[model samples]
Target: MQRANEALQTQVTELTHGKTDHQGSDRHTTTTVVNFQPFSQEIAEEEIPEHVKTLALDSYSGSSDPKEHLVYFNTRMVIAGVNDAVKCKLLPSTFRKSAMTWFTTLPPGSNADFTEFSTRFLSHFSTSRSVQATITAFLTVIQRENESIKSYMTRFNELSVYLEDSVPSVCVAAFKNGLREGRLNGNLKRHQETSMVEIRARARSYILEEEDNRQKQKRDGTTSLKGATHLGPASKFNQAKTNRPGPYQARLSTRPSAPKPLKVVNAAEASKETGTAGMNATCGGTMLNAPVSDILKEATCL
Candidate 1:
């Protein structure tokens, strides 16, 4: 029984190591190969298309959005008519630098399918997901002071395209509120229930009216200036003549007149003999002292 047990142990030892040669000088050794691929054995062994290898795809690094890269990759694969296994094989071609390094670090055969691979890839680079803009972010979209209504609308619409859930009424309100206060703003506000189509029509009409008014003002100014410039010498002469003073008031003295000289009148005084005769006539001595002729002359003088 002891000898049989010894023979069985020797057989087990030879099997554990390797088969010995007939001369016991050489051994037949077996080597085990580990598959380091992240994909299952079936996917790794799958034959890749020659056209797929030649096809140029957009490369991705750690910096850009990982999900976007996957989307683009999947789209290209679908167009190429490749299966999920080919897709898994071709994904590494799109990776570069850090992305390639991350791919190399994945556990061997950890991803059994394309879905599992994509899930793992997204999980690792989850921080790279794009953050969507909220409704409140639209509050910062204001019209510039010098910007025209058309320019403001274009800018507003450009931003609104990114906001998928934006309300039409809120956007309209924002547009109206952002406008600089003027006739256009007042007109828009007066019709609060107006739709976007109506608003555009009104804006178009307002813009056209403004342009027309500006053109009219320019034409009037130009006409007046031309009329003034072309005034003939004869017209100037007529204007000068009209401005002159009339005949009655022409060449009037500007200074005060000198005073008039006073005049004196001379009269002859009564003679002394006449005065004596008059005195004698008044008294009783006048009859004796005066002759009849003298008395008559004196009486006449008196």
Candidate 2:
């Protein structure tokens, strides 16, 4: 009976691979009609919102290998709709007992926290993200150049919790160092007293403050430029002609002159660096200045 079952499984595997090959050929034949996308495996715990990531991972749970699922999950989180912030509302009722209980316990309408979810999911389903590995990754985390301050803070807050044995000060230092330096860093650095709470608060406000200041500066500049007189296209010309001179001095001043031409002297002289004088009148599109001829002659002799 065992041998028969083994044989049946082998036959089934061969049929599956064969079917996949047939489907691949059909897809190639109808490229215009078919749009295919591969399933993802592992996800970056930091990247996607808590809810959507859960769904992606859950969908792949039935695959043959958890390791492949983990990799595909990572690819999905890093890519997918993470930047768009398209979050899903996960159904706790649909989840297995362990995850379902964790979800049900959260405050009403609250999404599962990414840290909590990752811990529960990885511990129960997959060993790809071991505790030590997660902690190490968290410790070495740095803010990506394209990542927003809010996203960076969110990820930092989630990861820092795993460092239960480490002091807050150490984690705070790591978080501070991880943030890309800007007005946010400057404001936080100004306050002598340090804490994650203080940093988080300031960071939240910093982006808004920077944006407002930028808008104000832009408005002021536009107004000033509009009010100012333009004698001609170039502002320097207006300044040079006026400069406390009489009002009529600007009128009397000639229009600003065009830039002086650069003297090439000779085309041959210019083309010397290029080895071939470019399409000369005498050369008739042939190479001038004996270009490559010496090398060719040397090769011929050899």
lDDT of 2 at 103: 42
- Residue runs of model 2 more than 4 Å from their true location after superposition: 1-131, 143-148, 161-167, 190-195, 214-302
Sliding window of 10 residues with minimal summed lDDT for model 2: 36-45
- The TM-score obtained by model 2 is 0.28
- Writing each residue's lDDT as its tens digit, candidate 2 over 1-302 gives 99999999999999999999999998886863343211112221224456564554444322133345445655665564553122222222234544444444444323334344434444444433334454567667787764556667778876665443334566667787787777677776787535666667667786565445545534443212221222123345444653566757766785687898655334466466567645363343323344476436544555
Best by lDDT: 1
lDDT per residue, candidate 1, 1-302, as tens digits?
99999999999998866644533433222211233578799998999999888998999886676777889999999999999999898898888888888988897888778999998887665433222342454577676764556666667766454332334576677677677777788888788744455667788876666455545535443223211222223344555765778775664644457887533211111224234333433333234234677556656665
Q: Give each model a TM-score.
A: 0.33, 0.28
Predicted structure with the largest TM-score when compared to the true one: 1
Instruction: Report residue 115 deviation for candidate 2 (angstroms).
Output: 16
Question: Which stretches of model 1 miss by more than 4 angstroms?
Answer: 1-35, 128-302
